[model samples]
Target chain A: MRRWLAAHWRAFSATLARFAGAPLTSLLNVTVIGTALALPLGFYLVLSNLQGLARDYSPQPQVSIFLNIDAQEADVREITQRLKSQPGIAGFRFVPRDQALKSLQSRTGLGDVIAGLGQNPLPDAFVVDAGRKATALESLRAEFARWPKVAEVHVDSDWARRLDSLLALGRYAVLMLASALALALVAITFNTIRLQILTQRDEIEVAKLIGATDGYIQRPFLYLGSLIGCTGGAVAWLMVWGALWVFNGQLRPLAELYGIPLTLAHLNGSDSMATLLFAGGLGWFGAWLSVRRHLHHYNPS
Target chain B: MTQIVLSGVHKRYPGGHEALANISLAINAGELVFVTGHSGAGKSTLLKLIAAIERPSTGSVIVNGQNIGTLRARGIPFLRRHLGLVFQDHKLLFDRSVIDNVLLPLDINGFDRREGTRRARAALDKVGLLHKEKAQPITLSGGEQQRLCIARAIVHRPAILLADEPTGNLDADYATEIGVLFRDFNQVGVTVVLATHDMQLAARLNPRLIEVRAGRLAA
Candidate 1:
């Protein structure tokens, strides 16, 4: 076990030396891989932040049930009781006709005109917070419209439904993009290892001739690939973080326009760890493939 | 005891060229034998067959009691670990320091780092190249590089040592020096098999000689 660990440590250090030997090339390759990975990762972050904003700020799907102008206090109380009993209704608030009239008068700055009319033009209304599903909210609106003394029911959840669908589509897009870029990462590592094998052909042949096992010969290359992958993953994480920081600065004005606090969340610890491991695994696989294909060709003869 | 044996061995390359045909030979433990032949007399093929680098086209080539013809790919490295090989081209890693070239086989075999370095230095000292241990192989002269190859091969202290044209590019002094080195190792009971066309070196060493001509043994 000690020897095994030493051998692996040697391979790892050898890989690091190789990177140090060719810093510019290693850096360029890592940059290319990191940039490619950052595209999907950035999009994913954006979609996640958008979903979070939608969750935090988007109002619940509400159905406003307006009563007839002749609706009495008894009718209002009866409808309130019915709404409370509705299974799908999350909650409801009652606005009496007089309260509604006063609100409109203050909001519109038409207090004198409303007072001159000698009557409250606005009807009593019940705003019901229903679940966010468009179909469920529409059905509830229709049911509320059928209630006695209810003149109309309005569903204000169309824009919310559209935003939800857009976010779902964005999530799918991020997934597909991530899948394609992951393949690109693997291919990049594969080609890099292939070139490394070719350049070290003499060293490999000599090592094999000296009784190096297949595992011994391939360890350094595998380490090289995985190191590149892991470094690239770290680079991608940094790129995403830097981009989010810049984008958040730009989004502050838009968030103020909507009068809501908005900021994109950086990759959590688990997500950052997953990215590094995923990249390292892909790199290891690529190196394995390249070595399996090429190492046999250098038999000591 | 027989350390290597060949019975009815034949080797044919991909282009239908026969490198060796109907050859049979054996060398006992601790024997220093020279394979003498012209440039294309299949001397290297004989060494390669003994080393398990190439299998016989027909019949068996056995080393250390294991038949080379039936050795698995995975078993080849283990077989080779017990044998030291010197190629005609030296096969030294020019990118590494001289000591590193000697340390490779030990590294491959997973010897402890400090122990491997000690052995590597001892091997280099034996070849009189200890002072040049830090220099790159490419900086060495032809004879020095050949010595480096020998140091690398013998660093693991294998039971059998095989050399292909070890003195092919050396001067008379260097060639005699190498021949003496082989004799010294053989005296210490390491079986040595060397292939060469240099009859002068062969005559000077006066060890057992097997001559080959046109892919067949010359009796």
Candidate 2:
């Protein structure tokens, strides 16, 4: 076991020496992998931050049921009681026609135009707080619109629902981009290891002739590939962090304009670790494939 | 007491060129045997067969009682670990120092670094290349490079030593020196099988000679 460990250490150290030997080529390969990985990671960060913004700014989705202008007080009372008994409705507030007119005047600054018309154009409404998904909110709106005294129902959380759909789309796009880039990363490692094997073909032949097992001969290349992948992953992580830092700096003024503390979160611990392990695993697989293919063709005799 | 045996071994390359044909031979443990032939006479092929570097086409090559013709790919390395091989090309790693070249076999066998280094020095000392241990192989003369290959082959102290034209590129003096080294190794109880086209070197060593002509053993 100790000898095995020592062999592995030697292989690892030899890989490190190769990297040190060709600093420029190794750096270029790692940079390419890092840039490829960063694209998907950057998209994910933006999507996640947008989702967080939506959650923080709009805690509960709301649907507004506007009654007809001719709605009687009894109809309003019935609608209020119905809302109170609704399962998904968290809460509701009744706005009389006069209160609706007053709020419209205060918010829109169209009170002079409204008063010149000599009538309150606002209708009594019930603003309902619903803690449900976009589909559920739409269903509730449709249900409320079918009521006798309801003129129209509007989901005030429509923007949030659109944002959610957009986020879902972004997540899918990130996944696709991640998958494609992961394959590219593997291909890069495969080609890199192939070239290394070719350059060291003489050494491999000699080693095999001198009783080096196939495992012993392949160990150094495997180490080289995994180290490249792991270093590239770290570079990708740093690039993402740097991008987020820049994005957060730009978002500061925009966030202050809306008066919400908006900062894009960095990748969590598990996510960072997953990125590194996944990259390393891809590198190892690529090296394995290249080595298996090339080494099989070697006839030391 | 037979350390190497070939029973009607034949080797044919992909181009249908038969290198060895229906040849059978045996070399006992601690015996020094020379395989002498002209170019293309299958001398190197015989050494490769004994070293398990090449599988016989239709016969068995038994080295240390193991049938090399039937040895699995994974088992070949273990068989080769008990054998030292010297190639005509002087396949020394040019990227490493002389000492590192010698240390490779021991490293492959998983010997401890300290002990491997000690044995590597001893092997270099045997080849009279210890003074150039830290020098790169590319810097060595033709004779020195061949000596370095010998040192690398013997560092692990393998039971059997197979040399395919060990002095093929050396001058008369260097050739004689290499022949003496093989004789000294054989005296210490290591089976030494050497292949060469140099009849003078073979005669000077005065060991058992097996001649090959047209891929068949010469009667």
Candidate 3:
């Protein structure tokens, strides 16, 4: 295994030298792959940061389940307990009508007017911090609608769900974009490798005639494809970072508007590894498929 | 013992062009054999079959101790190490220097750079082109280029040498020089098979001659 690794390293060194020797061409190749990879990565960031904001600001999007005006205090407490056991309410707290009216008056600065005319017209309520995920909260909303003691469930999380769906739509958009670009990616690699094979066809014929096995001849191209894909992955990482950096300087107002901080979605260790494997796998498979099909045509022997 | 054997070997293209049909031969070790025929007479195909480049559809080809007809695609490189192949063009790796080109087989054979370089120089010296080890293919004369190719092929001291029109593009003198090199290598127990259409040139070498006529062995 050590020896094979060493051999592959030497082969790769040779490949790198060749790749470096043609810098302009390889740079073009890398850039093409990078662009293909960056689109999905960029969209992923938009969704990731928004998801982060949604996660941190859970209280901002909670549903306020107001009880019937005559509902018992004990009944409200029972609902709070039941909500705790429910999956969609991440957590909740009860507020009696008087406290609710008091807090509302303070926030709206209508306390004096409310103090003169009102006997706590506001109903007893439960404030629910909905689940981090939008889909999970839907069931909870449905349950509230069916309850007899519930006067209304005012879902403040509506905007969040809307925003998340927009983000989810954005994710689907990225998926569709990635799927389309993935086809382009494969074609890009396939064409690049095909041209390379055509240019190297003479060498291939000699290798074949000299008793070099098809695998032996095919090995170097496999390495080349993997390297191309790996390089593209690195380029993609840089592109994602570069884009975030450029936009980072301009996002302070956006963050303020959203009332939360967002760390721009960057590729994590897992994502980076996945992208590397993904891009490289794309390139390697492309080259392998290309060579397997064309090596026979150049077999002069 | 027959060092190379083929019987009833045939290659039919999918479109039904019979590239080689019923090729049969036995070549002894230590013999310099010339496969002479017109173009498309199956000379290249026969050589290819022996090297395991193309699979023979109808019969067996045995080289050294193994039946090449039974060899897998992955087995060809290891099999190639036993044979040195030369083409009409020197087919040097343009990206590498002459010494580096010669060292390629050694590299593949798992030899270190220093030892490979030493063997490369010695092989170049044997071909009378040692001083030009640092030169690239594009810089060398036609004769010198082919000689360098010969050096690269023999650097590993392969058991057999396969030359496909080695002198096809050369002048008479360069052609004869390459023939002499093959003769010398054969004398040293390297089994030599020279594939060419130059019958007059084949006579000068006085080697065992196999005529390939329309893909059939006509020796």
Give the per-residue lDDT digits (tens) of candidate 2, residues A1-301. 9999999998899899999899999999999999989889888878887888788887588888999999998998899888877887778898888988888889999989888978888899888988776668878988898988899998898787788888999899999999999999999999999999999999998888888899999999999989989998999999999988898999999989998788899989998999999888988988888999897667686
Encode model 1's per-residue lDDT on A194-230: one tens digit a residue.
9999999999998888788999999999999999999
Clashes found in each candidate (C-alpha, N, C closer than 3 A): 0, 0, 1
Q: In order, what lDDT does every prediction score?
A: 0.91, 0.90, 0.82
lDDT of 3 by residue, B190-217 (tens): 9999999877688789999988888777
The RMSD of every model to the true structure, in order and in angstroms, is 2.4, 2.2, 4.2
Alpha carbon lDDT at A161, candidate 3: 72
- TM-scores of chain A across the candidates, in order, are 0.88, 0.91, 0.84
Query: Which candidate would rank higher by lDDT, 1 or 2?
Result: 1
What lDDT score goes with residue B182 in model 1? 96
Off by over 4 Å in 1: A68-78, A110-121, A131-151, A252-259
TM-score of 2: 0.93
What is candidate 3's lDDT per residue for A210-231, written digit by digit as tens? 5455665777788788888889
Ranking by TM-score: 2, 1, 3
Estimate, for each residue in B1-219, the C-alpha lDDT of model 2 and write its tens digit.
988889989999889999999999989999999999899899988888888888899888999989997889899889989998888889888888889889889889998899999999999999999999999999999988888888888888889999999999889999999999989999999999999999999889899999999899999
What ordering of candidates by lDDT runs from best to worst? 1, 2, 3
